[model samples]
Target chain A: MDVRHLSLPELREVIRRGQYTGPTPGLAPGYAQANVVILPQKYAFDFLLFCFRNPKPCPLLDVTDVGSPVPRMVAPEADLRTDVPRYRIWENGVLKAEVTDIRDYWRDDLVGFLLGCSFTFEAALLEAGIPVRHIEEGCNVPMFVTNRPCTPAGVFHGPMVVSMRPIPQEQVVRAVQVTSRFPAVHGAPVHIGDPEALGIRDLAKPDFGDPVTIRPGEVPVFWACGVTPQAVAMSAKPEFMITHAPGHMFITDPKDEELAVL
Target chain B: MDVRHLSLPELREVIRRGQYTGPTPGLAPGYAQANVVILPQKYAFDFLLFCFRNPKPCPLLDVTDVGSPVPRMVAPEADLRTDVPRYRIWENGVLKAEVTDIRDYWRDDLVGFLLGCSFTFEAALLEAGIPVRHIEEGCNVPMFVTNRPCTPAGVFHGPMVVSMRPIPQEQVVRAVQVTSRFPAVHGAPVHIGDPEALGIRDLAKPDFGDPVTIRPGEVPVFWACGVTPQAVAMSAKPEFMITHAPGHMFITDPKDEELAVL
Candidate 1:
């Protein structure tokens, strides 16, 4: 069965029932997807401030109330516990268990955060006729840790992580314009031409995800990556945290167009 | 002395020493001004979430570290305690005192928040040759309690407050186009015509600020007001709070144009 044609409720039901436990790339095509982060209430203020300070990497979509599983702003009817395809439980920066549901680990102090994912902007890029190399290569986007430091908020502090997309030199301007409209979803490129300017040593070897080909006429454009929060967590090492595993993301009810500014 | 010609640091210095304790409008030509709010660290998270949920009314400009007076993001060297010309001290929903400095009132667990003000967009509208009625009349912009409800977060919940401006029918589209660029400010108008639609029955009697005459060819336009947080504070009644007194705003280092999106 084609998952792309399914309604949001149908798609969420399938994921909740353990029918499909895979990366949520193509499912629910036009709707925005989110990167989930659950932390104890003690760490929530700092994390929220971190997102507010470093908006490019951490464009907050919606934050759940303390102990509540509902993301009231983005998706009201959705249950965060079992809606996502996969969940990662982390203890002191180390991955503990990958599960289909987090019912057993739900605590009253846990506050869930849904951050905007790149899938929304990539769709905008494709619509604008700009090529997304990672999507073409059928692999995860190349992510690298940059020398640029993110503004610290309490216990949250780390280097910014960025994702690289090779666009033709001629279309770089258009790519920037298209993505700039969606500030809620990591809008616009951080750096355009030189990777070494960002203190990146090698383009072939990325810190996370697969490296895509950089063609002769293409320019590497780096955008603030969604992996930044996870990378920050790996370094900051909060006592406990939960996130959507790898490519698995929580599908939202709003369409990608709704997130655009004008 | 022409206050408009003073540099940001110079302006700040004058305000710091109590040389200038007047309304900040037309003081600094192009610099952005912020609505200041200081609260105890305990209420910080809920207030931050409230701003996040209600972006239109409370577009966050910068947030200070706990017990720190400097707003590092928007103005690093500036001091929040002494920079703004005047501040209001509130205790249990009642106004306690209006003072020039908050140093004596500052506590270790307090946090400072800088929210975007309409002054930036008003300047933009003026630059576009659009007439702002309040400015023409030399009075405060009229603000009204709207029927629209802001999304509640934690302990903060109330009706949205909006400031009204009269614009000619022909210039309404341009007014929106110009203001839309500065989403960091209030952005576009929430309501274009008919004050009654927003539950603003009589334009002559505003809930706050002095009312201005609406000319024959002009229509009332409402934008989310910075006073919304204060209104919410009035209703929710946090234990202690500090806010910028009316017409007195904190001058930020970044230029108003810097806050605009392309």
Candidate 2:
């Protein structure tokens, strides 16, 4: 079945019923896919501040009401506990379990945050005729941890994590233009030419995801990644944390076009 | 003395000393002036979420650490308790007092939020040769409560409030182009023409501030006002709320240019 033809509610229903358990990329093609983070109410203020302080990496889409499972803005009918394809439960910042649903782990103090994901911008790039090397290579995008420190908010603080894409020198301008329109999703390139400028030693071996080929005429472009928040949360070693595992994302009802301002 | 020539810290210090206790419209010409809202920590999450959910009326410039008096992002060395020229204290949603400084009222649970004010974009309008009628009239800009409802978060919810300016029909496009650059401030007009469209019955009488004349060949253009949050907070009837009295604003160290993009 072509999931692209499905509406957001229909797609969410499939994921909820455990019928679809795949990476949400290219699914519900026009809808925005969000990065998920759930934390106790005690940490809500600091985490919200962290997102506000570091909008590039943590562009907040919608935050659920404290102790509520529904994302009133992004997906009113959707349940945060079961709507995502997969969940990674973290205890004291360490991954403890991976599950299809977090119903058993649900708590009254949990506050869910849905952050804008780069998949929306990637679609924009493809539409603009800019090549996304990782898609062509059929692998996850290359990600690296930079020496740049995110502005701290209470207990959340760590190095910024960035995703790299090789774009032809001429097309670099177009890539920046396309991505800048989607500020909700890690907008624009953080660095254009040099990896070492961000304190990254090697491009061939990324800290996360698969490394894509860097062609002769192309330069590496880096964008702030959603992973930065998850990584930062882990490093803080919070008493508890919950995140969407890797490629598995929470599909939001907001259309990709809704995110584009211009 | 040309207030524009004075640096931000110097102007803030002057305000702190009660030597500059007037409207801040023309003061510190190129620096950003902010609308201040200080609330207790208990309501901080809901209020922050309210600002996020309603960006136009409440474009947050900076939020101080919970219980901290300093606005670290926009005015790191400045003290929120003493920087603003005037403050209105609300107890149980009723205006209890107006004072030059809030030093005596400071509390450990207080959180100060600096919201972007239209002064920055008004500067942009003047630069583009668009007339700001209120500035010319030497009175406060007329503000109206729109029928439009802001996205509610917890207990903070209310109709959006907007400030109106009369512009020549020919300059409406230029006005939008100028204001669009400062989204941190209320970016662009929420309503371009026809007061009836916003359910505002009379242009001669405004809900707040003084009304300026709308001349021939000119239309009323409205931009989201920073006052919306204060109005909403008052309506919610929080146990306590503190805000900058109208006209007297919290001057930040950031230049107006720093808030602009592209």
Which has the greatest lDDT?
1
- Model 2: how far is A143 from its true place, Å? 1.1
Q: For candidate 1, lDDT tens digit of each residue in B1-262?
A: 4567788888999999988888898887799999999999998999999999999999999999999999999999999999999999999889999999999999999999999999999999999999998899888999999999999888999999999999999999999999999988989989999888888889999999998998999988899999998788667787899999988999999999999987
TM for candidate 1 is 0.98
Where is model 1 chain A poorest over a 10-residue stretch in terms of lDDT? A1-10
Per-residue CA lDDT of model 2 for A1-262, tens digit only, reads 4566777778888889887777888887788999999999999999999999999999999998888999999889899999998999999978899999999999999999999999999999999999999999999999999999998988889899999999999999999999988889998889999999999999999999998999999999999999999988888887988999888999888899899756
Off by over 4 Å in 2: A1-5, B1-5
The Cα error of candidate 1 at residue A33, in Å, is 0.4
**In order, what DockQ does each candidate have?**
0.93, 0.66
**What local lDDT score does residue B39 receive in model 1, on the 0 to 100 scale?**
92
Cα deviation of A241, candidate 2, in Å: 2.5
Q: What is the lDDT of residue A236 in candidate 2?
A: 81
Write model 1 residue lDDT over A1-262, tens digit each, in one string.
Answer: 4577788899999998888888888888899999999999999999999999999999999999999999998899999999998999999989999999999999999999999999999999999999999999999899999999999999999999999999999999999999999999999899998999999999999999999999999999999999998788667788899999988999998999999999
How accurate locally is residue A119 in candidate 2, as Cα lDDT from 0 to 100? 93
| CAPRI class assigned to model 1 | high
